[model samples]
Target: MSRLGSFAGDKMKTRGRKVRGSAYLAVPFVLLAFVATASTAFAATESTSKTAIFARVTWKVVKPGDAVDFDLQITNGARLGEDPVTYDLKILDLPEGWQEKFFYQGEQVKSLTLKPGESLTVTVEILTAPNSSTGIYQLTFMAYSWMAEYASTQSLSVELREPIREINLVATFPGIVAQVGETVQHSIVIQNRGESGESLRLSALAPEGWSTRFITQDKSEVSSVYLAAGQSITLALETETTDNATPGGYTLTVRASSEDGVVNALMELMIALREKENVSDFDFVSRFPEVTAEAGKSLTYPITLRNLSANDQEIILSVVTAPEKWKTAFKSGDTEVTRITLNPSQSLDLIFQATPPSEVSVGDYSIVVEAESGSTVKQVVFKAKVVGLYKLDVQPSTLYTSVTAGNPLTTTVKVTNSGLSPVTTLSIQVTAPSGWDVSFSPARALSLDPKDSYSFTVTVVPPSNTVAGDYLISVKALSDQYVSDEVQLRVTVEAPTSWALAGVVVAVIAVSLLIFIFKKFSRR
Candidate 1:
């Protein structure tokens, strides 16, 4: 055997040593004899009265209704004897509602054994009752052995604190069903059960593009709220789902937190896809629903004329209502078509051209086009805006004419306002070659409304001594608002018949006189 095992065996043998029968019978006589000498012997054993044992606790404070554990070290530091000693573990002066237990290693044990030059470590578990008072407590922990007639005591300080304050969170609806792209609203109840007020912060976690909001009792938004002790508040939560969110189950979490603790609730959202509506049959729509063009201008718009009925049909297209004097036509490609045949679900890209009259007002105007198939007719309206045109035109009644050199000739001159607005302060202007005079009847300026014409008499006179020839003159209407083109008027100037007659008479007289003079000269 090993030396340590042999030494332990020897100690066990010594403890089991048997006394002889005579020695055991004399126990009473020896005890009576020792009583007579006890006073003298007690003095010799007085120094051994102090046991060589020490104990210490590891920690101090614990909260009410909570379990606290501490390490306990017991040491037999003195060489009292050669035998192993057993010490009973105990606690004294404990609080009334508190319970204590001693454990050797991990098991509950009442006592522990230690040899000379040895120490033992154990755990002391203390449980505070739910109703324990909050205060500092002094506890005495003792390790004693009855057989050894020795004991050791250690003092410990333990504190019991008030129980923890708790808050509760309850959601009215934990799950909701919603349509895709819909907003969902729910409520949550937050209650404070503690004796003191608490400030709690609110937050939400959701997928991207989801929006959430928190509203209080007064319909005000806030990130946090203050709740008094034993008070409850209902919070409103509004959530918006995205358009592309899948039609399935999704989880959303909302949290309420404070400095003391945090709590959260889960919400399940089920989304359903919305249904689509069917399009109407037999529809006519313009590619460009609205158009802008100047007066007297033509604009063509492509229209999708569809026959959504489930059969072949013939449709006659015509213009029903339009701006006055505005011409409209329906054409397929480059050919004008009044009627067409379409199969089921057939559509034709027809070009619709509208020409607004030059006299049309400068504003938005609507044109309605009708399509007739059997007894059914569909009319589609389109908008056309006539913008202003700053233009004027001048035309002469007679561009070319004959005139006597000294006599005056008259012709009609027409001034037209081709613009959309009225032309005010209009005056006629005439340009003629040198030695020619031209004049208008109403020489002052006049006002003309859009697409309106003003007629004036133009008088032309050639210089009396002017040589007969062809001449040209230009006439134009001028105004601050409009100016007409310089229309050219041709005039052929001829000498007067009286001037021809006088020329002939003078010629005859000269000839007769010359004949007489020639006769006299011949006779001489």
Candidate 2:
């Protein structure tokens, strides 16, 4: 070789040698490329990469309280075969107040054997600093190895929480007997049920037509006083039912969430409205025949009392003032039907034997009955008199009651109210002997007046197959006001099988004719 050309050959050989820095730079890139290839081993690269970063980490976070969690991640980034390999962190990428305790596995990694898809887990604390920011932050992470600089880093995110103040409010309101729409001024027993004294916060939710205010023992401003656990404060909630407010029950919920993650709870308020007495359904039963009485005697009205509200109610049951010269005996049905005291949705019947004023005719008299239940009262009015004349005169002057089985024994029941007043809503029924069916034909609603008589058909049917025998028939009549005394239904049922003899004779004739024909034919 020429002397100069020999020198150039030496230079070219020297230039061809790989620089240590170039090797360093290629490390991360190779590692990254390997990882990329392994990730998509079957995938082709869309473009070539000039640089890459990779991470070797198993990131984790810890829970400090019920409200928060902390996490950390660690990774390394290096240039391929580079000297003094180092990394830089961007503050803008991290949370404003979050403390990023950068954990570096190493400044430089010198491994070429790393194939694609290889990774290691390391710890890097992304902790909430004492002075952590109040908003979300994103941090980028990258890692690298010798052969190639592995690329990529996950973005870590965090939520920053603001310091809050603790508040506890409690109240003890008094029981009240309020009329409908009545205003209740209530004082509540309040307490700071929390830890660490604080500038206690006090507030009220929507209270109906009500106002709230705190009353400190020392009259401290409710806004600024530091309240410790077990400490107490008083507040008043004033509200009144509207003039048109519905009478019933209501609830109010007041809450307290503690600052500094202290204790939290709430108070509940229950309000009730009292109502006036009103009448609902009212009915009556008589104490005469079957609930019977003499023609000259008076009847008792058994009235029932009922409560229809959710609250326990007390009702005052009473009879109105009696007219001069009147006689009556009254008793509560408690001893008769039910012995237990009645509660809500409960009722009791009372029987009153009210006689017409001495000079009053033996007729229905308007009697007023009143019941007072708690703050509720009701009055009911009904009429009663000398029970019907019951001199039920059967038409034709006699109840000729003879009925064959399968026949209707119709008789005119002239129920005359010989007494003075009109009888309304008469429900009549006729009873019969066992095995004998009885019914009132032309079934209907009926009403009768003083000395007035009603005519209705009473029907009795004896079974068509009734055996020859005598059966006593009976009848009963019930009205809204009275039940008639059971009347004797003198009925005789005869053996109605007389047609059996006729059927037998016909059968005998038919047999003889058949026999005669057979004999004649044989002879021929």
Candidate 3:
């Protein structure tokens, strides 16, 4: 060995061994690779350390075409003094016509800002389309960070349930306007919103004793009907109120039922009477509408006149019409006046006096009282019944008479007029039993004054074939101006006088002859 090699070896043994040139270059490359790996790990850690944002409930059940709410909570998770962060709320991949809104404290918000370690709660409302299919749908609620331009998403599961049976009833006129004792008809539209057909029965509930009917579009009456899916039908609802029904508002709850469910709709009916003020601006009322009086007597009526107009009015009182020979006058406050001034909603009482003629007939009479305002006139009719002051009677002197068969008998009938007025055209009427003929001697009618009387001869005849018995006869005196008077009598029928006398003679002769024969036999 050389002296230099030996010295280098000693140095190598004393110190560490020397590196090659390529190995030195590879050291810098290894350090660069380590730095790149550490950077990648830091970025992965940052990405995983996201803010806490999640829904209160992961899934919910809802009905199609219905609104649902999702409660969401976000917690800052950042260290204190970190920069304020802004996030935008949105719904990702939403179906067309679907609505999604973010609400903060009952108000909708588009974006939210939070400081470090701060927390926020928001409500998310989602509305599905009317025609949406039924199934489980996954929807994403995204919160995009403005600083990082990164989106954080939470999943919400919505389960939609389709309706089995649904019906909607609509009316063009929900309220019916009518008068008392009137029938009102209205059209209603029925729409089936379910996916299947339904058989629905229609019925109405209202005040007791009210009549209601359902008529279809073709005017046919039906108790129940069939409807197709998504079909619409129009029907008329007729309501008839009683004549004595009061005036007010009536509520009707109409219901349509199927095997699945029942649906109800409300209808308001407004009923009012034909008010006297509606015809005219004034009204006339009487305490008593009808009166009974004797013939030739005067009658007085009290009436109240009301001003129903919005403004004051001057009413002219007059008599529209009355019976012939009747004089009518109106008096107010001890003075005969035909004019009155009344304030709005004010009323005045007046007297209506009428004098009837002395020769007036006994019957019903009507008087009309009229009130006239500017361009308006109102009239009221009052009824008066007149009764007679006298009476008529028919009497018979002898009620019964004995008559032979095939013979006639006559009886006297007295007809008297007891009324204060004369009775004219008095005629006689007779009614007898079977197999008997009855008539009046004077077949014509006669007139009788008050307190006067007339006698009539009534003849009765029994047929030959009639058995000996008692029969009833009725006699009546009829008058044109008064009631008829009636009287009843009885007739007894007997055998002929000639036959009865012959029987008595034959009995006497037989007894005498028997005595003579007995004496002759004893003498022999």
Candidate 4:
């Protein structure tokens, strides 16, 4: 530490003369010169903790003095992506009062500060007392501190492992059915499936006549032990039902424990059991939903396309509609609903919104939405009505005409309310092409009685130098505040010519000549 302070003091004295630049340039210079900044920031983190961490530990009651070790990791929270410092590590699991000792390079470390951005990880040794009891046991790793941040963290865990004397118990009952007053026998198979021999032992759930026995049946049953790894032996279970034995199901658990933990085998006994249930194949077809809607109303429904095959069948479905006026939109979860494929026994549900146009006549319209699955076609029908009790019929479905420039042209428009119904908010508007002035008499609205006829004059004034020839003019007649007809017109304007006055001069000359001739004849 003193050496570092001396080096810093010397550099500070010598560097004081080099600080002549303006302070405004300091931030820019630092921002532009960032090559060593991140490295300097990372070097300030320190890890003060035991190099070896215990991620998981376990103790077994059967082995009384054994423990298991698993792999774990250590980290310096401040600096990541760097190698963790390593040292030999050992864990001690004791029966409450045993002493523990750990060595690193033959020296007992009181507390090793894993250097800046380093972690000491241990995986080589597993320490246990000559006597350790287990159901399960855990060891907490010592806390690690980051000195600069004043933050410390510790992790503790427990893991169940197969001890060196690991044993596996597998038992099975005979036949699928068992009943009272019947001698039902079952066998318990014991195997040392671990890396070491297990000390064997046995116990029975039912005593007396209903009992358990090794093949060499003895009360002190498991007296002969030391079953080697991967070795197997079978024990027998005999039960004689009494007159009062209930008819039901029961479970027998055969357990084998080691210095590590307990492993068990379950034997299920079924009493008064019937035959197993048989399930048929999935051969059901899906039905399309029907829709009924009122006039000027919209209804939405789902069409389910299902796959009823046993094997995965690529079923494709396509949709078609019979009504052009009805607005139909289909959306699947993601993409547009054009064609879809389904897996076996899977169904795709599509929501379809059907909106009926309000302008259709008030008669029942037959609409059909057909879904064509591969090799199968199904139809879903919808009844739509215009509710065409009564409707007003206009002579021209659309108004389209031409008018001279600067002329007010009047045309009779016919409106026939053929329906038993009368509509409101009727208005008329006449529009001309851009750059042409247009207006209509009673420009805002017209109240026409049923089967009414009215003539409205539309004055279209062509601007000076207005392009002569064809231009589109729109005349819109609205019903219920909606545009019902848009009529287009072709208007042509003749270019103003200079010859219009020449004929006046010729007429005047003829008349003057006649007068002069008459005077001369009269004088003679």
Off by over 4 Å in 4: 1-47, 50-74, 77-136, 141-431, 439-458, 466-472, 478-499, 502-524
lDDT for each candidate structure: 0.73, 0.49, 0.75, 0.49
Give the local distance difference test score of model 2: 0.49
Write candidate 2's Cα lDDT for 145-193 as tens digits: 2213322334343444443434545444544456665566557655654
Clash number by candidate, in order: 0, 58, 1, 20
lDDT of 3 by residue, 56-88 (tens): 697876677888889998766778878877878
TM-score between candidate 2 and the true structure: 0.29
Tens digit of per-residue lDDT, candidate 4, span 1-524: 34323322342233111112264356446433432432332233213322223344322222434444444444444355543432322232222532334434556543444443555543323344454333333332233332233222222333223355456666665433554555556666778777667665555454224544444444334523457768887766555544455555654444455533454333443335233333322222324355555455676666666667665545333445546677776667645575655677876777666676655544555556655544556666655444433344434333555444554444544445543334565656667667777666665334444445544555677765665577766665666623445656556664444333676788899999999999999999
Candidate 3 stretches greater than 4 Å from native: 1-260, 263-280, 309-312, 332-335, 391-524
What lDDT is obtained when candidate 3 is compared to the true structure?
Answer: 0.75
Could you estimate the TM-score for every candidate?
0.36, 0.29, 0.31, 0.29
What pairs collide in candidate 3? 390-419
Predictions: Cα RMSD each:
30.6, 20.3, 30.3, 22.1
The candidate maximizing lDDT is 3
Candidate 2: regions farther than 4 A off? 1-133, 137-158, 163-408, 414-425, 431-439, 446-453, 461-465, 478-488, 494-524
Residues 356-470, model 1: lDDT tens digits = 7666777898888988877677888888877777677888998889888888899998888877777778878888888677788787555788778888888888988878888
